[model samples]
Target: MKIVESHKTDVDNYIITHHYLRSAPAGARLRLWVKDNSDNVIGAMMWGRPTARTYDYNRILELTRLYLIDDTEHCAESKALGMARKYIRKHLPEIRGLISYSSTGEGHKGTVYLADGWFAVGVTRAAAWNKQGRKNIDKSQKIRWVRSV
Candidate 1:
């Protein structure tokens, strides 16, 4: 498989909204498609500015979404990641690093990130408070990973 720069419109309906957990792409700076030997799109990835502030906000980009077509052979995710890293290095020279998260709530341990040699930054517990006459806490956790571009 190979990675190619993609248009937001080309991937949103066919890939992200339909296949990804978030169902939308907001603040996306770059979109990518994973294609097979026959050139059929099998996966997609999206990179954008991090929603929360970080030390190197200007130089850091988050791999917000990565979805792959099930039933494919192994290493597809790894290949896409490697290619995406190269693409970023070649095309987006200003970026010095990349970040991505795998949610424990979603049963993900960031296998792809680990396979790509990303640094493990530990886990984060994210909580949301809702005040509707009473207090409610919505909580989830994600493991963070980073890699230099």
Candidate 2:
């Protein structure tokens, strides 16, 4: 397994194929991909500097770019998110609040998020990123469920 700073090499593919964490900027703190021995970009996670979103205020840091190939299994994503939260606390301790967004039908994933201790903050009526139509969360998508780190 390898963890490194995110590069553009296959970023487009990662973004095009994933959600929630995909829309993050090319560069951000902790943008990582967990690859197998073959280096098949399996999992990723990241955190953007605090920014204003549909739900939380800018004072809260945003969790971004978290994705994993479906076959990699949940343990890998958990490890990545756990490491990510740890890294966030280490580097941005002052900014203690962490927020992540997900769609509504994502019930099972939501359970995982909750088990990880993320609380349901609220729902966002607007797209988390409005300018990007693809990122737009229509009626089908729900707002972010936030957590304190």
lDDT of 1 by residue, 3-118 (tens): 88876467665554545354544678888888998898888888889755854667888987788888666978987999999999999899999998887876788888888899
Residue-wise C-alpha lDDT for candidate 2, range 40-79, written one tens digit per residue: 7776666666445453444466765567777875566656
Q: Which 10-residue window in model 2 sums to the lowest lDDT?
A: 50-59
C-alpha RMSD values across all candidates: 3.8, 4.2
Q: Where does candidate 2 clash, by residue pair?
A: 21-65
lDDT of each: 0.78, 0.61
Clashes of each: 0, 1
Off by over 4 Å in 1: 20-22, 129-139
Compute the lDDT for candidate 1: 0.78
In candidate 2, position 9 carries an lDDT of 43
